[model samples]
Target: MTAGRSRARGVATAALLGALLSTTAGCGSSPSAESAETDGPKSTWEEPASYSYTLTSSTQVLAGTFRVAVRDGKVTEAVGADEDSRRQAHDLPGEVPTIGTLLQTLDRARSEGADTAEAGYAADGRPVRISLDWDKNSIDDEALYTISSFEPTPG
Candidate 1:
C-alpha cells in the first residue's frame, strides 16, 4: 500500500475505534444515564432539610440554625452560623464533636428534654422541619456563640 494511503487508513481506524468504545460504555448503563438526565441538577446536599433553633450555654446565648440534606441516609450538608457555640459544645468535658455533632446533640436534647419539635418530608422525600425553644446550656456563657447549626443557610 502507498505510505500516504496507509497513514490515512490508520487515522480512520483510530477514530472509529474511539467512537465504538464510547458508544459501548454509554450503552452499558441505561439506568444511570436516565437518572443523570432526569434528576435535573444535583445539589451538594441531597434531599436538603432546613431547621432553626436556639442554643443557650453557660457562656453564650446563641440562635442556632441549619440545613441538612441527606442522600442514601448519609449526611451531605451540616453548616451553621454559631461556630463559637459549636466549638464550645465540642470542647465540653464529655462531648465528642464533628461536623454533624450538632444534630446528634439536638436529637439527644429532644429525646431527653421537653421540646415540641416536628419533622416531615418535603419535595423528593427530603425531610424538613423546625425545633424551637431548644436549649444547649452546657457551654459557658462567655463563649462566642453565633447563629450556629449543622448546614446553615447563607445570610
Candidate 2:
C-alpha cells in the first residue's frame, strides 16, 4: 500500500514537471507577434512596413487584424476575417481602419495636431499602450483609442 501511494505521488510530480517544462519551452527564440507584448521600456515609435493589430474603442473592436491596401496615406481596402466582413469593409471605403490608418493616426498626433497624446511601447519599440484624444482631457476623456496585440507582418 505504501509503495502504491509513493508511485502515485511520483506520477503527480512528473506530471507537474512536464507541464512546467512545456510552458517554458514555448518561450523560445521565435515569439509570435501576439506574444510580443510590451510590458517594458518604450523607445521611439517605429512603424513596421506592414502589420496586424487589434483595435479597441469605447464601444467596439475589430475582432482580429484587418488587412488593407494602402494608397496615398489611407486604407484603400479593409480585409476582414471572413467573406462577409471583407465585403462590408471594402464597401465602407475610408470608414474602415487598417494598419496604415493606425500608424497614420500616431504620426498625425505629432505632426498634424492632437489634443492629447500618451503612449507606451514594447522592447522592439512598437506602441502597445496608446491613449490619444482628438477632444477632451483626462478628466472628460472621449475619442481616445487603445491599440494592442500589434504584430508586424512580413513585407
Count the clashes in each prediction. 16, 0
Model-by-model lDDT, in order?
A: 0.34, 0.48
lDDT of 1 at 155: 26
Regions of candidate 2 where Cα sits further than 4 Å from its true position: 1-43, 58-91, 98-100, 110-114, 137-141
Clash-forming residue pairs, model 2: none
Error of 1 at 97 (Å): 11
8-111: candidate 2 lDDT, tens digit per residue: 54455345434543674577776454334332233356556566565543212222234554444445456665674565566555556654455566566655
Give the TM-scores of the predictions, in the order they appear: 0.23, 0.43
Name the TM-score of candidate 1: 0.23
Which candidate gets the maximum TM-score versus the true structure? 2
